[model samples]
Target: MKETGQFEVYVEVLRAVIIAVIFLFLLWSDRKNDLKSWDGWRYILNGFFFLTFATTIDITDNYPSLSKFYIIGPTVLEAILEKIVGYLLGSILLALGFFKFVPLIADYRREAEARRKAEEFSKNILSSVDEGFIIIDENYRILSANRAFLESAGVEFTEAVGKKCYAVSHHSEKPCYESGEECAVMHTFQTGKPHNVLHKHISSDGSPYYVEIKSYPFSRENGRVKSVIEVLNDVTEKRQLEEQLAHSQKLEAVGQLAGGIAHDFNNIVTAIMGYAKLIKKKNASIEEAKKYAEQILLVAEKANSLTKSLLIFSRKGTLEVMPISVNDIILGMSELFRVVVGRKIELETDLLDEDIMIMADKGQIEQILLNLISNAKDAMPKGGKIKIKTAFAKLGETFIKVHNLEPAERYALITVSDEGEGMDDETKARIFEPFFTTKPVGKGTGLGLSMVYGIVKQHKGYIKVESKKGIGSKFYIYFPETNEMPIGMDDSTDKFFSGNGEKILLAEDDNHIRRLMENCLTDYGYKVVVASNGNEAVKVFCENDDIELAVIDYIMPEKDGLEASKEIKKINPNVKILFLSGFSDNNIEREINDEIKNAELLTKPILPERLLNKVREILSKEKELTSLDSDKLH
Candidate 1:
């Protein structure tokens, strides 16, 4: 019995040692993990307590005297009872630990996987964004940058990391705050609030671009600003498009203004030219009287030219491009410009001695001149000198680049300078913008420079302006030079073409213009029947069967020239019709029907001589046709 009890004690000792060893191994394995967790440590503690209890029962069973000294129960019963309690406690602890730790481990694994996916998603969002994005720490050091930011900075990710934000964007050694430039990121970091700013960034290629920067603050839980997230949007093209739209609107406004005044001005010019021509023709025998009449004719022609310039400036006239002498235009306008600038202002010219030819509309070129002179006159409110100069320029690559001109071209340069209050840089930049003016309301239309700019562009030319605030302003206009010969003036006007006693119908809207036309035509020996408008012209044509031809003004109250011509053609198919317009040929073509045959179109303020010659030519053609028809009848 003694031997058996000793063997049992040894077996219990071995069992206790095995349990202790297994529990210790579990603790060691979980040491690197969250062993502080009750689930991990409680199982080991329970197993240790159970091992202690079992070993105590085993030693007591072997020595009954020690058991009696420690407890009043029988050794065998105490040992069995202890074993059952300890085993139950150990099993419960092990089961509780397994249940708690299994779910906790699964949750931990799931959380780790989700965190990884979130990081990947954030990276994808940053990479796919179109605008440049960057993250910088409070110290302005770049912590992270997206692909767009990397490209905009002209650097790789490796190079951008750890660099200063200002160094990367502004190419500076210090922060933008130190340089006096408003830094959105720095502000965001300092105030822990969002900030926005517009910055002009110089690219690596030495070109400048505009960007709108919006920055958001990244803060800690305690509301301490940790970093800033910057969003950069390029806005250069958007700003340019806005400027272009504004310019177009201004041009349209000015064009409308020009169109409104065109008809009345053309009528006045027609009356003046007609009366002057009649005076010159009637006084040809008196040399002095003829000379005075010729001067009146010259002034009338200049007025007519001015009217044409207004039409061109309004973009309401067709371009009549031909080789023209620039000097003649400038010299002819010299007296008018002097008068316009007033006696306070002195007008001077430095024209090229030799003629400089250019392929351009004569009226459009004159418009350019008039606009520039008018602008100069306005600049000098008090009294100043206005200088008009002309020179031939050979433009090369360097010159073209500096002046923003076409490459490898020759230009006829006309410079108009003023000794007046000049403009600042900002004002000079927008001088050619339509409706942009420094002059007060009603004092200026702000369309002069804009019209000049449009006319120059239409003629395939360029304008450059130089101004100093207190000094003066200078405008340089460059027209592409031409080698083609200019058209010679017609001296046929020295002799008048007298009309035979042929019945003619005339239509005019203006009373003065109509009376002048009647006197001129009657003096030339044509029996003239006058009408006030297109409807009257049609009526006159139907009532007067012997009328050889009809002259109709394009724009009238009741019916336009085109409608009257159509009606007259129906009444007399063989009658000759001459259509006169104050507007451009393009506008007339668009208004007139294409079916009207044996019809002629002329632009007004027509010279009296040209009118008579056209009438005579058309009448002769009609007579020839009539004679052909007569011979056919015979």
Candidate 2:
């Protein structure tokens, strides 16, 4: 609205100032770009600068006092040149600059959009997962965390980001490695590969829980791990469930075994009762009574054998573990094997020439052969070849995993192959299950193979079977090999059973067995002193200075055989001990093998002659026991 000359001059000066500001801003924006890409920015900036200079010259033309320039010419002379060079040239440069910049702007917009969407997609996926996911840099700093991770950590995004990953997840001042916990993330960074491990982590609420932590590493151009992505899965419930299932299966198996044992005992009792009645009713002669008595003793021995079998199957009894040759057991059972298989079947043995010795129960090993051969004989009613082989095996990775055995180098492999009716995959899979058998209900107790399995497992051995429906079956048993020499099989001895008036202290809780043993020892020219319990036995041994031997039962009411033996040895380390046990505990067996150097273990229900022979053996081995004491002292 102002028509004054002064107002017009002020408006022109303001327009030139605005153009000059725009030119400076454009040059600042192009500073970050490459020199080659500066062509478009150069044009736009120069246009603004020219336009501003031309307007300035025009504004100066209003004031004729100060209208001069060095880069151009006098204000009056450049008035025409200002329109051509400043306005026209500036407009042309801006038009060309915008033309070149158009495609560049469009490309920037498209690339920016693609990156944003990719980030959004990744966020959605991580947030939706149930497992906690996080990306952490090599410095242990948390770069990014998903919604799942934030919630699990019981913290907000502000609380977690940029903080050390161990600080958030472990709630610790130091890394997991410092706390004796192997950090999967750190392991991956160092190894340059994925790592997984079981980790105990603290939740946001500070409760401890177990997680399976999986970590992956990302490398840079220099092949160094730059960052790690970790996924955490809680597995606390799965491990608990597995333990409960195993316990339940064990209880069920015990119940089934008890029932089977009860039924078998009832059959044995009936036989004994029938034989007793026959002997009582027989009035023919002393010879007839003697024959009936022998029959009764034979049936009673069967009951004792049954008791031993029960002990082995239940895995509660002790094993007289000794280094025994596998070839010897197989050969020893050959006669019994032939009788059981009959003339219709052919039995062959392929034993290794080199002795393969393992620490195991000799009787248990014999039982294994008997059970397997019996199983094979039953499978082939029409008679077939049964082959037993023994060898030294390496027990490599595959064998160890298949049998779930501890990693070891040497194993004694015993293979029993039968050319008989075999089992299918389904039947073979559960063959080791207790109370599982293909035989008819009344035909088999289903405990034979199970007993073998229990014995093998108790020995820290493994058994596996391969079978085909119409073909045949092969069973492989592996026992850890030992360097110890095989036990001597020689039964002949020159030592006499009768003692030379040597005093013996016999301790047994059983009235009948103890009295019989005392009389048996006394009759053999030995002075026998008896004690009812282990406490009394210890007292009597202390009273009698000339007691040559102390025989005590393994399991007693007040004090056990092991304890009494320890006390006796403390008094006289040179005295020999003979331990008799009806129900031998595994701990006692281990003590006899390891700590008790002056003692020998003898299983109970032993014949009177055998008991006398054992006492004589221990008494005669005084020099031997003294030698052991000297060796142990050294």
Best by lDDT: 2
Q: Per-residue alpha-carbon lDDT of model 1 for 389-470, expressed as tens digits? A: 9998887767667755544357899999998899999999998876677876555657678778877876767789999987
Q: Each candidate's TM vs. the true structure?
A: 0.52, 0.56
Number of the predicted model whose TM-score against the real structure is largest: 2
Tens digit of per-residue lDDT, candidate 2, span 248-314: 8677656666666678678778887877787788474778778877887787776776777778777
lDDT of 1: 0.80
Clashing residue pairs, candidate 2? Answer: none
Residue pairs with clashing backbones, model 1: none
| Minimal lDDT window, size 10, model 1 | 61-70
Error of 1 at 61 (Å): 25
The lDDT per prediction is 0.80, 0.81
